[model samples]
Target: MLKVLIVDDDKNSREVIKLALERIYEVEVALNGVHALELMKKNSYDVVICDYVMNEVDGIEVLKKMRKSGNNAVFILITAFGSSDTAIKAIQEGAFEYLSKPFKMSKLKQILAEIEKSLSEKKKEEAVETNKDFEDEQIIADSPVFLEVLKQMARIASSDVPVLITGESGVGKEVVAKSIHKYSKRKKGPFVAVNCNAIPPSLLESELFGYEKGAFTGADKSKPGYFEQAQKGTLFLDEIGDLEFDLQVKLLRVLQENCVRRVGGMKDIKLDVRYIFATNVDLEQKVAEGKFRADLYYRLKVAEIRVPPLRERTEDIIPLANYFIKKYNFYNREIRLSQGAERLLLKYRFPGNVRELENIIRASLIKARYTGVIMPGDLGLKEEHIKELNREEILDALKKAGNNRKKAAEILGISRATFYRLLKKFSIE
Candidate 1:
């Protein structure tokens, strides 16, 4: 059963809310903010409803405290004097919904119904997703940010909207596209990948839209193109920002018409394919520069997903490294990462994101030859490794400051929260 915690200074208000919700939710009541916090720490709740005003602690403070403590329960604020400022504050403090006091029990019930239905659907989708191995589209990450990205991917997969994946080169944009296709309803169909820049302009036309048997020099036999081949499937166009201007017009026409024309054929053939475009470059910038078509850019960006680079989300470093280690370890020997090696890998900025991490792990494993533990030397880190090994480093600074994170962050030329975040990323106690 779903649980809800109610916090109100007034005993009568608390009792009324409990009575209204107890029929459906397993309701717990708290007299004030302090009591509410105590109850929150003691038990897990699906939802929390707190009164806006109280003597010891206000609803905003209680909500902030709960959020800072990593409580993800849905919070609803009950306010007597509702205003724009109050509503904004409640939302900013992570309240899922706010109800003005003296509101009907029916209204509250309606909101609860919506929340329950939404949670139920989300759970069902997750259960279906969890059954798939998704090896090729495996996303290795423990960071909250990256996990949210995965969740966004799942939500986007339920639709056939064209998705434009944006990220730096080697940040796994293609992997994200493939994952979307696998999770989507079109999973049973083909997944065709096309590199827009890789194909020559003269041939790209024929490559994307097939020609008649006698249309071109090498067209001895009529063959279907990418769009035709990806019928009822997904067509992933990678680096689409680099597509030529003239070809962009043709592609836009195809998108607008939902059909393709053979290079020499008379009529257009209707298509039923989901389009997923990915690019490392800023297509918006290209559009501004008049290097790309404005209409095509708009069409491609119908639903955009940004794949974050590795350096920003440091928590993914270790897991991605381990994944690659297991991937390339053909002999399945006991090759493991040493503490020093882990430190070095985390310290060095992975400019190449997941791809770079995988490459590093592969090279390191090959250097180690699956004999035993992989050391810092196996990582092939250059000057960055030397800088990380300095005696008067951030780690030493932390020790000197008696593990005072603020002073350690100042010593390391970074923010205090960043220092703490790095500590957690590296699994430093």
Candidate 2:
């Protein structure tokens, strides 16, 4: 469970919040900001909810002190006496969220839920980064279709040529890129991965190409961008198809010239970097449509690898699901899929691919924590595909529901109307 520290001078406010959140979180309350800071010295908290007004030290001061101490807890500032400027200042100072006092408990719960998900995702990413041995062992390539892609990756790993990986979202393009980097001679150096579309276009140029001091309004000090940081290594630019047209030209120049000039620098900084780009978009179509530069497309596509979608590579689904189950085994539960659950997963078309499978497995584990065996219903395949359940399955559901149609529909993970249709199709009274 996540630990949360609530800092408020008012005893009623503190007790109310503690009562509301203690069930979901390991919560502790502080009498004031000063008390909160003292508690912080003894224990780490995932989140801090602090009232902006208090004696000895205010919430803003506590936040600054915590940040200065290298605490990365999500700080939520609440103030009954706050102006727009104060809210802005709190946010600018790195508070995760700022809200006025008298905020609804539901709203706070919603924010906390969002924070939980965000933190969970961050932890997953960090785990992937730090656990290389586990990752190498768990690479899902059971299907011949995907194995061929791996063979191609092996062929290209030693080569310095640019690589373009094309596939749908969540098709593991970045994973392939990382494998290439790991096997390459440049593996000793950095493997800097960046999503070209994730960063705002306005700031992306400086982020990719670095900047000199005094280059822009906030250029307080010279900073090396992604390209410079990836010197003597591979730079994986994911979603390169979504890159702004203007940056395409700059990137082409860098590839051709083998150097980069900081935003306000005079001299070009030469780099020995390999480039691997991935995109779900069809660059050929973009080129024909004049949205992408043909020259840049050709430059990036020295070797192209297209990863097949998950539905096409169904052979790897169960293995990948099991890998995710192990990856997110938070409670160390010996969770396994029931026969019905395995069949359901194999039959369903995973539109979101491997990522979706992982999410389903993680959630199913939560639902199956006590039983240690995931069932079909726990898998949460309540889509149109649930209709794939045959007459026998429908009859079983009806028996489970004691012949109540509505309850049977619920058991079958379908609407009552759809259940009626299924019953008619099967000639069941």
Candidate 3:
């Protein structure tokens, strides 16, 4: 059972709350904040229910201290002196909920039930995410070029040097990074992936470096940043090319010092994080253009691995497609690709790379579920690049072939079945 701590100055109030929660959780009572903090240091709590107003140390102070110490237990502050401002302040101080006195006991119980359900769901999601990270290491490398990239990853995994993975946007750079982490000595540790471009440039620094309780406005409690969280683990910084110049300098400093200081923190916390950075953009060109820092680029590029794009490694397309089909075959449908579909896939260049192929497979599998065979039309490659052989081009081919479909197929460099599908798709008579 999850553990809960109830802290109230009044003995009656403390006992009442404890008695109510004891049936659902392993409950503990504290007379005041001092006692609660003492109990906290000794025990791990999943939730903390504390009165807002108390003697010696108040509830807000307790909450702040707990957060500072990195205890992420759900805190709910109850108070008789309730106001909009007080509730807001409590929430800003990191209280999960601020309940006014004289509320229904049933209401509190409902809230607890909701919290429990949400926590369970959160755990499930985390498990799925962790499982995905493990799955990412299971890369499909049928092509000789991709196999060489895997070899480089293995060589890089043996040492602790920083890695810079350069590839196109959907070429599975992060997957390669995860595979490296999985094969490394630090395989047992966590792998934290942060997308530099995804986070806003303004908040990215604080998010990356963390901040103290009074770091800035609304920072009522201390929080550890990504650097601190990734200690004893691998920190994969994706899209490092998009990092701001100022943060780049700070990052360079962190790399050089092997430690990080929170935004308003007085002392530096040493890090044992293995760094892996990835970018689709050319960092050397960015350096030449004065966008990216040369020194930081050099620091991160200690061991460089460039992933070949899908177009460059077309040999892996059908195998990767089949792999994705099997992965998404949750209903265990006997799905297979048509020869025409395989030829279509090989003939077309996948500018979006493996990610696109997976999406295509997922969508195609759904469309072909009943048939057990994914056709060229089911692959949904008709959206963008299908325009390469436009309606006019087909018409021209038909005109040149004297309106014979088979002759037109020959003229257009496609199979007769594909030509018929295109005619039906474009509603050409």
Candidate 4:
């Protein structure tokens, strides 16, 4: 069941929200930020609803305090202050959603629904693997480039320095990050990953720092952010290049001070965490272009590892393909890839890298079904799907050549060997 923490000074308001949400959530409540923090330290909650106004601590202060502590629960702020600036500030602090006083119960329900969706997505991503499942002494070397990267990873994993992994999209950066955490001394703690690009800039800060109850318009309770959740563990920041400029400064401060302040709270919470960040973009170029900060780059790149693209590490193609084939075969309880299918996969250049290779193998498995041999046709690689071929021109040429393989191959500017491959690809023969 989803857990919700409610913080409101008014007894009536707290009870109303608790009753309404209890049907769908396991609800907890606190009269103020201090009590909320005490409760948070003892238990983990999924969502927090905080009121914006209180005598001792306001909603923003609560958020600031939560962030400093590094808790990352979803926070929704409720306030009577309906100004645009307040809303923007609340969102910037990481309130999942803001609600005004005297709002309809239906609106609150809708926000909860969104939270459920977000939680579901998070669970799906987390289901990939656990830290224990990662092999500490595993040598992932199907290619020279990967071998070099593994060597570097070993050196970096031995220390407590921050590491920034740069690579193309879908190149297994997360897998690499997990491997680092698994090899590190802090392997026993939680490994939390936050996708900076996936969350909006307005909510990114609060999501990272956390918020106090009654900090803004719709904060019903206090909550923690990633920094707190990853205490004595590794925090993987994916797509670090996409972080907003203002948040970047705050993050730099946290890294430098080794502490965080929640969105509306007054105290700083010390943290011991290993920061592992990954980005597909060129951070140096981004810094030069003023899109990324130079100082922050230096701090994060104290250790750097770059993952080679699939095309650059072509030697790994067959191994990776077969690995995926075997992996999916177990999951799907299906036949293995045939020799012909493996050859076809070897010829393709996967722009999407390892992720693309995994998907291809999965698709082939489905097409092969319970059949023991996965054929090249099961991959569904159409002639036009092959790179360097425009659909219209290829169709026109095929018509002009009267569908003759040799002539069409000539007009298409590819060798007959390649043409035969295309014929088998399109199932023309």
Clashing pairs in 1: none
- Residue pair clashes in candidate 3: none
Q: Put down candidate 1 lDDT per residue, 251-336, tens digits, no spaces.
A: 99999999999988998999999999999998888989999988899999989999898887889887777767767765333456
* Ranking 1 against 2 by TM-score, winner: 2
TM-score of each: 0.60, 0.65, 0.61, 0.59
Best by TM-score: 2
Clashes of each: 0, 0, 0, 52
TM-score of 2: 0.65
Model 4 lDDT per residue over 195-295, tens place: 99889888888889989999777889998999899999999999999888999999999999999999999999999999999999999999999999899
Rank candidates, lDDT, best first. 2, 3, 1, 4
lDDT of each: 0.80, 0.84, 0.82, 0.78
Alpha-carbon shift of residue 74 in model 3 (angstroms): 50
> In model 1, what is the error at residue 40, expressed in angstroms?
62
* Residue 429 in model 4: lDDT: 45
Better of 1 and 3 by TM-score: 3
lDDT of 3 at 180: 94
lDDT of 3 at 263: 94
Q: Candidate 2 — what's its lDDT?
A: 0.84
Q: What clash count does candidate 4 reach?
A: 52
Superposing every Cα of model 1 onto the true structure, what RMSD results? 22.5
Looking at candidate 3, what is the lDDT of residue 58?
Answer: 93
